[model samples]
Target: MTQSYKIVIPVFFIGFLAGAGFWYLFSPALFDRVVSEELPAGFDLSELRSGEFRDVDGAHRGSGKAQVLVSPAGAALLRFTDFEVTNGPDLEVWLVKDPDPQKSADVSASQWLSLGPLRGNKGDQTYVIPEGTNPSEWGSAVIWCEQFGVLFSVATLSEAKI
Candidate 1:
């Protein structure tokens, strides 16, 4: 083997490995995770407010329902049903004060609380709203990409009778 071939072969392999890792982290790969969140046992969940998700842009579209649920005792939960969003490196669930958030700036400009990292990009999942946090005060439930500062989806919550 030539001296140049030895160096070229190793360099090529290293580049391939690096590219694979980047793709795995940053690519728009689709994955689904369904979670059936159980409450404290005896109580039933009632929808307080709910909204249908709207895509922020073509690349970061989402479609589903985001429901803010509460129990009889005032325990609150945020749930996403029939949910799917564009997968990203780091996505978070945020309750923002904006009634209608169309851009990423709306999230940062308004009063907001982060529920936490989104459990899954596609599927049914639940996030526990922090104790004493009033879900009613927040108007939008957003799927935000923290790493890139992008808004994937926003749902403008409306009061529900049931």
Candidate 2:
């Protein structure tokens, strides 16, 4: 190999390794935080677990579906699963606390704790609930499908520990 080629090759390999390490350390938590900020208020983060499902109204076929999973504390590992309306219109899911039950009556939407939106499909998204927002105050989660005009949600334990 040429003398110049030897130096270039090592530098390139080192840069690649460094980039990989950085992503490994920050990607999971960073992604989680972004998703959490989008959720509505009143939704508890500790009670979140795998395999939960939230269904919206079918009348408004344009609406969507969503779910949540709360990871161990300090890890900020919250997973959200959602299904967009393929046959009709898209929907947005939020992680709220104790939302108004009357909002599900149609026309108007509920007021949740507000975690944020479940932007995409299932299994690919994660969010981080910021510190100081005591998970103890979380009551339930609300999912509002903008296109279908429906509110789907799940009620959770107020003091459930992650």
Candidate 3:
């Protein structure tokens, strides 16, 4: 091979590796989420407490609706409906006891329950608060990026006047 060709080959390989590394570090998880999970057959949706999500920190950017539903059997479920937020890495759904947390530092000091990694960046989803965990104690629903300690968004919980 010519000297010029040899140098070009090595440079191309290095460029490829660097591109892959950056993609892995910053690209959001690609999830094609459709079809809402079915609530138990006897679950009642008539009585639900709802809230509206707000942006927290520059990292958390999205608007959505949150709902706390009690089934006829007394099981509590948290559902996010009409939700859309910016994609993030290692995101989680958290029910926070703090009424207002503006940044990562504020979130680090607060008590929270992990509902699990977020299902998707957009659309409707549901999470079952483990048996015996009181949703009432939490004042907001938070989209948290666990890997980067970023709070993506927060929704203040309030009883819907029926």
Candidate 4:
């Protein structure tokens, strides 16, 4: 090969590697956050038990849906059976426990989980809370669409039985 051609090949390869590496390191969490914010308006958490959550048409930047379940007091026990995202960027799911539902100051730290870019028919992924998190204190669980900046939150009325 010509000298210039050899140099061009190596440069292209290096660029590809760099891009892939960057995505690998940051894409999951970043995409999740973006999708978390893009959740649709009037999307109900209670409906998730039925196994399908649909977003309002054209309300958000992208098209996607999410479901959430929590203890009566709002602790998240299982998240994922009712989840789906399509035609959008990635989504992030978080579990937040707050003793005082009206105030943000009483909220416990949040746990971040990642989902998908989901161009077509992406599957669901479930999350189980750790033992340290008290089920009764859980006030809300949120699913965020990172790209469109939407947040879908479900609040529990009492402590979860499980």
**C-alpha local distance difference test of each model:** 0.87, 0.44, 0.80, 0.41
lDDT of 1 by residue, 7-118 (tens): 9999999999999988877675555544555445676889999999998988888999999989988999998888888788788999999999889887888988999998
Give all TM-scores, in the order shown.
0.83, 0.41, 0.82, 0.35
Best candidate per lDDT, number? 1
lDDT (10s digit) by residue, model 2, range 18-47:
999777654532442222224444545554
Candidate 1 local distance difference test against the native: 0.87
List the candidate 2 regions with Cα displacement exceeding 4 Å.
Answer: 1-51, 60-75, 81-90, 99-111, 146-149, 153-162
Q: Candidate 4's error at 17, in angstroms? A: 2.2
| Residue-pair clash count for candidate 1 | 0
lDDT of 4 at 15: 99
Give me the displacement of residue 149 in model 3, in angstroms: 1.0
User: Which candidate do you rate higher for TM-score, 1 or 3?
Assistant: 1
Better of 2 and 3 by TM-score: 3
The residue ranges of model 4 lying beyond 4 angstroms of the native Cα positions read: 1-6, 18-76, 86-93, 98-126, 143-162
lDDT of 3 by residue, 1-162 (tens): 699999999999999999997887667744434436555675566435678888765655878888888775668888888888777778899988887777777778999899998888888888988898776788888889898888888888877678
Per-residue lDDT of 44-93 in model 4, one digit per residue for the tens? 43322212243423432222233344444444434443344433334454
Query: Which whole-number lDDT from 0 to 100 does residue 92 have in model 1?
Result: 93
Residue-level error in angstroms, candidate 3, position 6: 9.7
